[model samples]
Target: MRQLNKFTFNICPTVSIHNQINLLSNEDIKYTFNDFQKNKQIISCVDNFSEIERDECHIYFCPYESKEYHKITNNFPGGIFIHVHEIALFDEQPFEHKSFFQISQSFRFMKKLTLINDKRSRKLHDNNEHLSIIKYPHLSQLDLSEAQDDYIEQFLVDTKTCLPNSFYLCCRLSSTEKSDTTLCKKYNMNKLFKSAFVMFNCIFQGLSLFDRRFNQLRVLHVNSSWIRYSSRLTINNTENLPNLKCFSLYCDTDTVVYDELIVPLLHRMLDLEKLHLYLIIGYKNTFIDGNNLKRNIINHMPPLNIFTFNIRTTVHLHNLN
Candidate 1:
């Protein structure tokens, strides 16, 4: 114990004590929590609630299907940082699930929030009265990937709230459950696309880019399959993406590289420094006029430092002189 404590200080005395505690094993969790309990130090729980810190620690409760989950959370000190995953279970008579508003108002110092895989039973209600009271100025990241559409809309309605630089809103929806139009209208999808500055590795399935603008976008990645299927479809307001630096497109078919789609799209990204195009041509004798396409792409785009075009059997790389 003496050697371990001495080694900890030697590594970094100012390192967050919570991070150091997280390195312990399950058996060590119990012993460490017990030690913290004895010393009355701030105890933070991530994944399990082996120790109760009352009102003096951050707590992250992963999906736990115990009726005692709510009781454990209720005992946490007000204004404490808490992250709850999925739905909080309850087994009492007239069983009801906890709402996001309820969870948000329960703590005063909510620093970071992440909700994942919330079933329909515990879906957040839009009409919750406590929506106005929920505020977290210190929130560094928010992930609502598995939350319901209504819940996400309600949370984002308060535009005054400062969103973190890294925000994730990608959710998996069944094809039959919701149509593209319904989902787009419910979440104001176009507004979100324009506002985000750096979008990394996102799938835009069922989204329409007609007349939409990307004002602050720096990096954009989209699969060609995400584009709506229409003979007359065109991406409007491409000029609005003035800050786009890195653009990538994954084409499942060769037909998406026409002037209406790929050519015009690349022409709009005047500030792009990196461009990657992945084309998966089927098992048939096919070839793209690479020399012609290369000359055109170089003429339209800025002086790029890295450019990669990968087809099924051919690879083209260009570093401009």
Candidate 2:
């Protein structure tokens, strides 16, 4: 197959000639060109290359340090999944020198990209143009953080295809809460995409998280520490998320958000099938309006297939009993 690069080469997930599809176990260990002398095994492992079966190689994984390796992987005829340290945007660095914007252009055939980064950066904001080139109908998953709303809005409106099926944002709650609300408020979630999965890990204030209707959203995941008081949390918009199937929420009681918020939010998700909550109970004494809350929730949302609840507690359950 090495000699068959002339034709479209496709590699399946099972083919192990080169462990290119699955990332190397030790790839997460930090290394540098200087450390190559002592880590020959690691160096040789990354240096090895083989002809990719273009048809089967829909997913590609690359290290954050290997700019040259990415140049080669980008040639694959299918989607590319590259490991990244973070969103790669550079001010003075040359475009050819490992910028996300440049890396994106390298794979014109790529339909989806799954970037793995431990942190978020403003570099994603700098790569707006390259991100727009994505063929929306083909792209399945996109995981990014600290991306600007202008770029996201443009993607929803300008694309010739539907938005991605699943989107993830991993970011610090404090940083985004102060800057993101205004930008996110300007866009209409219902009009953005027909059916989608959205996940966010960031702090939100006011109705930033609930004000907008998600008409086509099927799955939703949110991990935030603080909560604000807003009926938007309790208000249901069937026209926005008519088919919501699953919802997972993580919250702490030290904030204004509470079970009170959940009931109202539950009422809004008319078709919710599964519910997962991670609630942290603080020292504050509180009463459970369980009957009224559950009644409202059951009245609005769909029957559950499976329900899982995890509540952090310092007091005994018998106390509530």
The top-ranked prediction according to lDDT is: 2
Q: Give the best candidate by TM-score.
A: 1
Q: How close is every model to the real structure, measured as TM-score? A: 0.52, 0.51
For model 1, residues 1-321, the per-residue Cα lDDT tens digits are 644531111010122445455454434534554643243333343233333221123332222222222332333333333443322322111111333435555543444454443334232443445434455444433444444444354456544233344333333333222253344445444444332222212233312342343445566655544322343323343454577687777656434334444566677777778888776532223345676567658777766778888766333334222
RMSD, one per candidate, in order: 10.9, 11.7
Model 1: weakest 10-residue lDDT segment is 6-15
Give the per-residue lDDT of model 2 (tens digit) for 223-246: 765655543233332333467788
**Over all chains combined, what TM-score does candidate 1 have?**
0.52
Model 1: residues with Cα > 4 Å off, grouped in runs: 1-114, 121-125, 128-130, 136-178, 182-207, 223-228, 231-240, 251-260, 281-286, 313-321
